[model samples]
Target: MSAQLFVVATPIGHLDDMTFRAVEVLKSVAVIAAEDTRQSIQLLRHFNIITPLTACHDHNENMVIDQLIGRLKNGENIALVSDAGTPLISDPGFKLVRAAQEHGIRVTPVPGACAAIAALSSVGLPSDRFSFEGFLPSKSSQRLLQLEKLKDETQTLIFYEAPHRILASVKDMAQVFGADRPVGFAREITKTFETIKKMTLAELVSLIERDHNQQKGEIVLVIGGAAKEVDLDQLKLDQLLTRLLEDLSVKAASQLAADLSGVKKKIAYQRALELTAEKEQDKLDRDLN
Candidate 1:
């Protein structure tokens, strides 16, 4: 049998989160490629796995791809791990995995803890459909711009935020997505100081502002999506437009219709114009008859 590449998931916080298979694979592999050797060493020491570890992080992953792949081709099973949660989830190892696949090397996942999924499972938000938007921009301006684009998204939005930038990011979320928007804030998940709460964006900002402790920790924010607007029935909307067209000009009728129905003025105006033309055609047909 050919050698395989195992992508292992280490514990994000608590050491016990490491899985049985993860420990077994780590021990059985010829070598382990870690995002940070120093950090991974502690976990290995705790588990008593003395597998030789090498660095395969974002900065040097590209440089070491050839070497890692050569080792795999030479019939050496290797395991890839990050300092925390599953690798390649806002962590490194993507390039190496791709390279392994390109060379037809089997890439196996020894799945366990992932901060995003771990938080999502317990955040009390709708988990049916969600978008994991890794991390927002650090700069306030860029972050706001990014939020502006997602303001209208209707699927639950999940984001990983740094401890230092949590306050500003939540404030920006309230500004663009609205203060009343619901959010699930999970901090230090699977750890001693774990906190998971569902609250409004405004309340979140306030909590982070008043309590400095909320600002610290590995943060996962599960924000409720934009409320889906219920559109008025088309027939009812058309009838309302026709009634208004009887006593109002197209522009005035459309403006009033938009205000009354909560539809855009441009859409109302186009419908109003269509109704007006239809009424005129009926009149001309009656006159001809």
Candidate 2:
């Protein structure tokens, strides 16, 4: 039988958020692979879990993966964990997970606290459809280019941002998505100083600028998607042409209405002629009465 690779989730903040299953798995695993052994050791000690932790972070994951896999194939169960939250959630451990699967090793997810999902549930934004754009480019220029591309997205957008980059990121969002765009700001999630609030992109920028505290701690940004576009129907187009034809010639009214309503000029002109005849008939009838 192939030993299972348990991918356990640790608490993002409050230690109590750690699940009973996660604790049991950590205690039972032959060894735990942690992003930062030093950081993870503290949590293990708190729970009286003495599972030895080995480093498997971004820098060393490639180097130590083979050794970890070798142990798994030997029928020794291994647990993969990040410094916080679920592994491979904007964290390391993907390569190891992939390698384990490739070797026909069983990979199981022991789920628990995830910062992104926590914020989304309470943000009051459209949760039906969402896009999790894990951290954006650290460079300002690259970040701007990325935001420009997503400006037209029609689903709620989620992004995990670093404390140091919070203010700049919000500012860029406002500039690209417009100051009036609605956004949800969550900082220090599940911690004592946790803050979750919804406001316009402009408001968030001002709050972060004036209050340095808002710039600190683990942050997740939930931005409202671009408003869905409404299509202009033929009836609405004719109404527009009628209004314009009262003050402008047939040619002018058709051209202006087409430009305003995004309709073809030829169609607008034909509609304008029909409206003009209707108006003239109404006038003649009124004169006779």
Candidate 3:
């Protein structure tokens, strides 16, 4: 029988958030595939775990997948972990998991802290329907283009951003989705400096700029969806009636405005009747000319 592959989740910030099962899996696995050996060392040291770890980040993932598979074929259980959060979520390890499955190995998840979920749970935004946009493009033009594509998206949008780029990203969102769009910003989740604030896109931009301290730490931005558009023709009809009441009779104005604005004649005629008495004497004076 082939050995199993375990995909483990590491704490995003707080070490205490690590689950009991996750620790056990990490301790018992024959070898651990880590994104960064240095970061994983600190995590392992906290729990006093001495399991040997090997690097398997984006740079070396393709080269190491076959080797990890070989170990699994020899009845060795392995655990895959990213520097933080869940493996394969904006991280490496998919190839290894797929290879294990192909060789008839069982793949199990040891879930724990995930930054995206942590932010969503407390951001005070609509949770029923939402979309996760992991990270925007680094370039300003590219990022704006990306935002434009999602301008019409009706679902709540979630995004991950680095501290250095948070201000620019928020500004771009404000530009594309209107300044008054509601937004939530979660920073340094699970850590001592954790902060989550809800405000309009413009307000958020000003807040971040005012407080230099707010610019640090990992960021998760949640923005409300677009608002519905009003019917332009309906608005034009009302404007037309108000203008025509000055010179033309109410009945004549209603008929002309209804044809021009494509509004129902009956409704326009009823509104014209309301204005008839107020301007009846004026209509008679205009008719004499």
Candidate 4:
């Protein structure tokens, strides 16, 4: 095979979820850059894939990418995989992919299973319009601030949370989105002890508290969003607009603000125009002074 970088997706829980193409690529590739060599070895052993795995995680990706790129340029096919699910989906590989693209190396995707999509597919939520907010902030305060920003979102919300912090995260969600918001929780999906349940956020919290085992393992939370246009705080709206305005145009910022804060786009558009005018006025005043 010519030199190329393959982005591969592996199983989240069930081994069978690993696709045939993924196994072939893992076997045929010259090198497998795994997020965790030790973990990837287990999967390799299961499939009898003798390919050697090299470490490629967030901390070392930048330092070691040049070496991998050199190997790829020399006609070696390399596959990038995470510990579970898809790489770069709340996982590492962003830097590597960008580097490969920048260097004009062929990048291919060998897709299989993804936890977020798997969980969302089964959950009875409106998937047509949804946002994947993977892995919320680790700290409670930051998590709450993020939840507050997303409180008024109208589309279904998806989140991947760790076991230790699942309870705490759920509590924050309940507080920020209210107790009655409909949500679904999928735990250890596709595994022997897999469980998928849906209920109000309050009830889900109670369930997790009552059953300690439910707190363990991989988790995907699908939350239903605000049913109608929400009354968002002007300060919060402005704060969101300001941050979004940094990279996006006024029209795009307004639309995104509406999607995130559950405000009508037309209203957000007006607000964006006003914010731009204020910025210009402030600049003009400074110039005059």
Candidate 5:
């Protein structure tokens, strides 16, 4: 009989969030695979858990998976944990779990805290349908491009960001998703300094700039979904087309407007033509009248 693999979840920040079952699983496991041995040690010490821990972070995951599978085959129970939260979520351990299943070993989840879910639940954003975008690209250009791709995504977006990059990320999100888009910034979840603020992208940018201290801590950002409808009057449409035409040709302007406003391209094209004709006629009418 092969040993079982326990996918355990640890506290995101508050130690009390650590479940009783998770502690038991950690103590009973023959060996524990942790993303960071040093970080996991503190948690173990707090709970007086003496189980041996081995490093299985991104650097050594591929190499360690084989050894972990062998241990499970030998009927040695194992527990996998990240520095915080659940294993295999923006952490290392998927390969070992997959290998265990292939070898007919049982893999059980001891569910508990998750930063994304915790933030989303409390943020009061659209929880019905949401997409988790674990982390944005480090480079500014790449991050902007990534945000552009998701600009029109209807489902709410959740992102994990480091303290150092949170402000820049929020700025880029505002640029791509519009400054008025609602966003939730949850920082240092479950800790004494824990804060979750709901505001528009523009407001958040100003808030971060106003207080330098707001930039410190693990950040979970939740952006509201794309608008389902856009109300544009003739004047607004004319202004939009005029701005778009500055950079794009007439056909391109129509296409770009349709994409940005979620209006049909054919209709936008016709409107663009009408606007042009109206401008030309207005010029003629002014000359005649």
Candidate 6:
């Protein structure tokens, strides 16, 4: 009833996931700013929501944002909905939301199904401290660069990838994170022919490569973080010990090496002793020669 911006969430796939409150909001609002009016019209028709539709997608949001905000200022309530799922999550409408907030207009959320959250819920990965990295870059170079940056991330990573690029992105992830990294591939979430598989990156790549039918619809990829590994190479440990031995005693050097290399303190201490003894022996042999 109030002249506020209602950010409504629609179903990603299954129409039943559409909320009662979201439908009511759409019915009551004066205008619905949709990502795709054609697809949204079909959705609204299904729910008997005859609200006037307006296109406010990524291509034209910037130009028409002020006009939409002016209508809000003139005491007209508006409902913003995307083609699917929640708007402004790997979707357009951030500009309008920001502009609306700037002009003292209230922006309320009508929360419901989100593909990322839905896929994440059943993916069996750590959900407590997860990062929703919406969509990966389509370009191979940029995508690889982004993956390189995320190589050391310790939290679960969620990504939205297109069907065509899903295999390529998974391949890139396997290359960057190693084949053993756990990946939960959720395809066509909430709709018929939905496939959710949990396995290592290598296994996922193999499955998708063999089954071409798996590469069809929207995909949400949930990848586990890199496991903490304590397998530091002995050569690297000796290198650190040699450098630290120059400035500090064996115990101090060993402790620093243990912290840096993730090796046990006692193990580093013993190695440090060996390196020191070897250095002394070498010096003695050199003097005798």
lDDT of 1 by residue, 1-289 (tens): 4999999999989999999999999999999999999999999999999999999999999999999999999999999999999999999999999999999999999999998998888878888999999999999999999999999999999999999999999999999999999999999998999999999999999999999999898999999988887765877789899999889999999999999999899999999999889889999999999
Q: lDDT per model, in order?
A: 0.94, 0.95, 0.89, 0.94, 0.91, 0.93
Write model 6 residue lDDT over 100-157, tens digit each, in one string.
9999999999999898998889989898888999888999899999999998888999
Tens digits of per-residue lDDT, candidate 5, 1-289, equal 7589999999999999999999999999999999999999999999999999999888998898889888988889999999999888777888888888888899999999999999999998999999999999999999999999999998999999988998899999999999999999999999989999999999999999999989998889999999876555656777898888767777999998888877789988998888778878999999998
lDDT of 3 by residue, 1-289 (tens): 6578999999999999999999999899999999999999999999999999999999998899889989988999999999999988778998888888898889999988888888888989888898989999998999999999999887888998988998999999999999999998999999999999889999999999999888998888988877757668656776789788778877889998888877888988887776666567788889999
* RMSD versus native structure for model 4: 13.7
Q: Can you write out model 4's per-residue Cα lDDT over 98-135, one digit (the tens) per residue? A: 99999899999988888899889987888999999999
Regions of model 4 farther than 4 Å from truth: 230-289
Question: Which residue runs does candidate 6 get wrong by more than 4 Å?
Answer: 229-289
Consecutive 10-residue window with the lowest summed lDDT within model 4: 226-235
Candidate 2: pairs in clash = none
Candidate achieving the largest TM-score:
2
Q: What is the lDDT of candidate 6?
A: 0.93
4 or 6, greater by TM-score: 6
Reference-based TM-score, model 6: 0.79
Residue-level lDDT of model 2, residues 77-192, one tens digit each, is 99999989999999999999999999999999999999999999998999999999999999999999999999999999999999999999999999999999999999988999
Name the regions of candidate 1 deviating beyond 4 angstroms. Answer: 234-289
Q: Is candidate 2 or candidate 5 better by TM-score?
A: 2
